[model samples]
Target: MPERTHVPVAIIGAGQAGLSVSWYLGRHGIEHLVIEAETPVHAWTDTRWDNFTLVTPNWHCRLPGYSYAGDDPDGFMKRDEVVEWLNGWLDTFNPPLRTHTRVTRLRQGADGGFELTLVSADAEQLLTADDVVIATGGYPLPVIPTFARTLDPAVRQLHSEEYKNADQLPDGAVMVVGTGQSGAQIAEDLHLAGRTVHLAMGKAPRVARFYRGRDCMTWLADMGVYDVGVQEYPGGQAAREKTNHYVTGRDGGRDIDLREFAAQGMHLYGLLEDGRDSRLQFAPTLRESLDSADATYNSICADIDRHIEREGIEAPPATRYEPVWEPDDEPTALDLAAAGVTSIVWAIGYRPDYRWIEASVFDGGGRPMQTRGVTALPGLAFIGLPWMYTWGSGRFHGIDRDAAHIAASIIDRVARGSAGSVVTDGATLATTP
Candidate 1:
């Protein structure tokens, strides 16, 4: 065994989440190490598409003591611009970051802390820390269905993260699975590029980009939708399971209308059910999914309408969205060769992977069972989970707040010499003053 290094705290990611935690801990003069398998902002730099942009405006890109300083606060930052913006934080505090380091195993230390087995550059190293913060974002592994292996080798397949542009695919129609943000956007990208597109739509909701003379998100922000707590949501935990509304920040911003895409010669299908070679089966859900998305869109419009009237804000006149296109036939099956779909993009989203974390703190779904980032176990916590506390918990808009609370909790534990007041269920962690 390599010599075990000891530290007061170890943050297991270097993304915005871990860096935000480091900023807060540094403020309190706490010593910690931030370890990353890649450089800081690895996901931003590596995973996203070339044209990828923040769905939220630049203003929402908030870290500790860092907010968008660019002139275009209302504009969305493109992929490279986002990378540059996030890299600015590395300069702001110059955190203690260890790149090219991967924690292969994390287990409870024999004596009152945590032990991490690391493999980096073909060398093994061991680390022990009194406290550990798992700040990796909720999505860890891109999930492609097992049936994907049954696809004919002639048909190229790529996950949404792997898709760069239409030119990267075979010179034929493209099929994009799932109607989550990525799927919708990628389908649109291919369609705009004049490539034939077959989109498998899901039940993901849609929101208008602009409403009543302002960005819908701006109104929602003012109405405190983003600040609504997990417990406060009417759907409760189910709200966290819902896919995010499909919209886009590409070329300024716009609402993704799958109906319009269908009108423009793009073949839209329902939820994919199974596959046999180049032939795939789909559920007869095209109309239902489209209606459901529009219902959610108009619902948000109605909520915003009421807010505008209640607050007497002089906003533009509002009207409900009527469906621009309707599906007359339910497309339940697709023959890839016949449809000329030479490529398929699996935009089915990702699953969380915490196998390296050897602890009892995770739920059945592998999510850390933490309340506002504090676990029931002493000296262990999680940050950057979707809806961990608020809608902004995993995004830049709220990482600072969550990190501050967790940092305060760590500080309290350090002072008291034991973890204090963390509970397994429905307990709120104290906010730092």
Candidate 2:
């Protein structure tokens, strides 16, 4: 028989999202237990490459109880700095945590609560909680296309999550697919290491590194761009479906546009369509994609200019960006062997995994159907998902707000005795808490 423990709340994951919620719950005098499959901030400590640094500036790290007080607010934090900060925060607050524990299964109990099967070191235990919070993060699994398996056996392929450094790759030209932030940064890293590089262009937006002597992120925050809710912003649903903007934290935080990569001698191509027998097919949308990205960049800068004029803020002279459009001669196909491409890094995005969750909390696309972290289920909630409530919901600086909301909801549910089931009525949640 497994040992059974009951708590008022059970939170899964120990990353930034989970920790933020824990801080809020602690402040609210709620009894909760946090279950982590590995060490705190495992994504940063275990998965990221050795040279990875946060793309967001240090000032953006704003948890509920803890805030970044470092002097270099404009600078980025490296992997080690992030891990160290999380560890220090954990020790200072000391929220009830059980590390090295993984939740194998989660289901509703007979008493309208949650029953979680937790396993650690070959021992299984059952935990019952009045409320359950899933903070497993947005990027649970790397999204790799099926065509990658058709490549030649000699070719080494890896996803961005698996890539470490240039030395870990084969000694030849490298093809990096997907021009998101990871793809751009990895391509630049390989190029600096003296390797021939080819990048596949995607519909990723581009933003300047600095505008009017302020970081683009700082400007976005100041302009309330990050606080824009998904339902409130124009084209919010379509924008949520697209990949993140292309930017880099390297070289003292700089804009990494495709034109910059092409000028740096990196061959650019359209999206990777298919691959078979060492031959790859690309869509003929290279120019279209680059133009779209450039237009997005220009529009953002124009908004900032308007804001500056309206507020009469004294800022440095701004230099407008010039569009760079380089046409690809062969945008349809490429022979991998002839191009000396020995390794391919798929810098594609990630998808959420909800197989372990035995509830109707997800949609057909596996996205949690929640409103500001509160689902139809009175005692169930989610945190740290991209665009969960606002543009910044998944970001470190933005998660605290959602966390507070969910924590308050959980407190209310517990006070109400965690009764009733979750039901939806056409985009409206009817709960009996």
Candidate 3:
């Protein structure tokens, strides 16, 4: 057995959030033990698609006090840039971290602190801490439906997480499912790569890039919309659902508009209304149904226009809607025979995997139930969830704000030892009451 260790703070997942927490803890003269399942920046270096670039521009890529130390702030940063930045941050902060060590379980100890079970090839290890930060991020697991498992074996299929680029796919027409940013971007890439593509668009809004021009996202942050549900209020959960709940693609990244997909010899279809049926029927009235998606589309396009004007460039005309590009709930029969797509890439979104954390902290849907980062149980905190605190909370631009708050909480908990203490000598504090 490996020698057990003890620390005042235990941090899980050395991603952006974990790094942020470590940096803050170090700044405050607090010692911490950070546990990462893989090498630093594993998700960005290993899991992301090859051609991926951040949707957020460089200028806003600020995490706490550290900014992306690249040449251009307005320019986009590739996946490698992000990875390098993370590694650089680690080098600078030099926090105590155990790589290749996966945290298998977290339990509340008799002392009301946290006990984390660690696993590796050689031996098991355990660590205790007064405060725990779950910075494991939101992309722990890919969401795959059971029905997708039953598809014909001849057809090659993969989740977006497994996809790297066009070379990873086999020769044939491709069917890209879902209409979110991933689906749209992947489908556009495949179609552009000389493959016949069929997109199975669900009830999703087709958004555009408006993030470049006016600092609207920053404006939203100032409006406190991201913090709306997180802070105590009536209908907090419901309000978060209305504003910041969904994963949307960066509209400013891709130029292939949904309205132009059909013109580029792409086929767009809809799912069968009968939830059980796999058969897809043609619905010619997609343009009418697409009206519902206008909110997302307009938001993106408006941001794009602002970007153009702010950059002092002549604004381009709004993308004219083609009648065929309209939304269709019931899509026409898609002829796979003609399309010759041998691969089906599901660009659907992600789901959190709380299996490693066996505590009773998650809801029935496997989502953690927390007041801010604080779970129902003490000594446990969740960091780096999208909109966990604000619109930019999960992004590089916003995670520091939440991390600072969480770090302050951890510092106070460590200092007081007892939750009942209502005062701290010289530090920011948080209380249950």
Candidate 4:
């Protein structure tokens, strides 16, 4: 067995969340090691399409001490620019990072720490830490329905991650499933490339790229919508379970209106109900789906309108969106071969996986039970999850608060032992919390 290494803190990911925690801990003279299964590029982000740009504006690209200072706060960062931003943050702190190493298992140690089984190319080693921050993010597993296996062998299927550009796909009509952020955007990407794109709509809502005078994101932020906490979310689980509102940042950012695409001849269908024998079945809810999405779009515009009126701000008149195209009849099925759809892009979202961490911190649904990043387990926390506390928990704009909370929790423990009290901006963490 290789020698066991120990540290005051061990971060289980090298992504922004991990790096943020590392920076905070280091600032206070805390000894920690940031470990990762990959290298300079994160596994999840490395799979983005070549033309992908952030849906949120560059101004929201705030990670710990490294906030965006570029000229284009309103513009979104391209794929390479995003990568550089992360790398730039990494370089800024220069944490004691170990890349190309995966932690196979995490168990509670008998001595009240964490036992991590580290595996790399050369050898398997053991490490221990008093506090462990699981910054691997919430979406750890890509989800493809099992029915995908039953599709025609002639049809090629690619996950959104594997998609680079329209040219990479087989030459033929393309079917894009799951009208979430990835699905809507990918479908647009294909349509723009002159590909005959067919989309399967899901319940995911839509938001306009711009409202009256500014990006809808800016309007929402100013109105304090993104600051809404998970528990305080008015939609509750119904909204939390839904994918984010679909919009795009391509070409200086614009709303992704599937209706507009349909008006332009892109085939639209309801959710993909099943697939087999070279054919696919869809729910006859395409019309309803489109209407619901439009309702959401108008709802957001109304919210912004109310905000402007309440603040008495002299802005342009608000605009309400009406459906540009409505499905006459909800398409119920598609003959993949007949439609000449040689490829299918599965853009469904991911499911979280935390089986590696042997802790009883999850609820019945396997969702972590915690306030912010702090859990019932001492010195154990989860970071970079969607709505971990607020809507921006997973995004760079609000990650610093969560990371600072975890770092503060760890620091309190180091200063006052297991019985220490760590109080953050709004909550108390650590033992006896």
User: Per-candidate TM vs. native?
Assistant: 0.95, 0.93, 0.82, 0.95
| 329 Cα displacement, candidate 1 (Å) | 0.7
RMSD of 4: 2.9
User: Each candidate's lDDT (Cα)?
Assistant: 0.87, 0.84, 0.67, 0.86
Deviation in Å, model 1, residue 66 alpha carbon: 0.9
What stretches of model 1 exceed 4 Å from their correct place? 417-433
Ten-residue region with minimum lDDT total, candidate 3: 242-251
Ranked by lDDT, the better of candidates 2 and 3 is 2
Tens-digit lDDT string for candidate 3 (158-254)? 9877878887888887888776657766776676678778877655655443333333344344345445544554565643333221222233344
The clash count for each model shown is: 0, 0, 18, 0
Q: What's model 1's TM-score?
A: 0.95
Among the numbered candidates, top lDDT falls to 1
Quote model 2's TM-score: 0.93
Pick the TM-score winner.
1
> Candidate 4: minimum summed lDDT over ten consecutive residues — where?
424-433
lDDT of 3: 0.67
- Across residues 64-180, which tens digit of lDDT does each residue of candidate 2 receive? 767788888999888889888777777778788999999999999988899999999979999999889998987689988998888898889999999889999989999999988
User: Candidate 2: lDDT of 341?
Assistant: 93
**Candidate 4: where is the Cα deviation over 4 Å?**
41-45, 237-239, 417-433
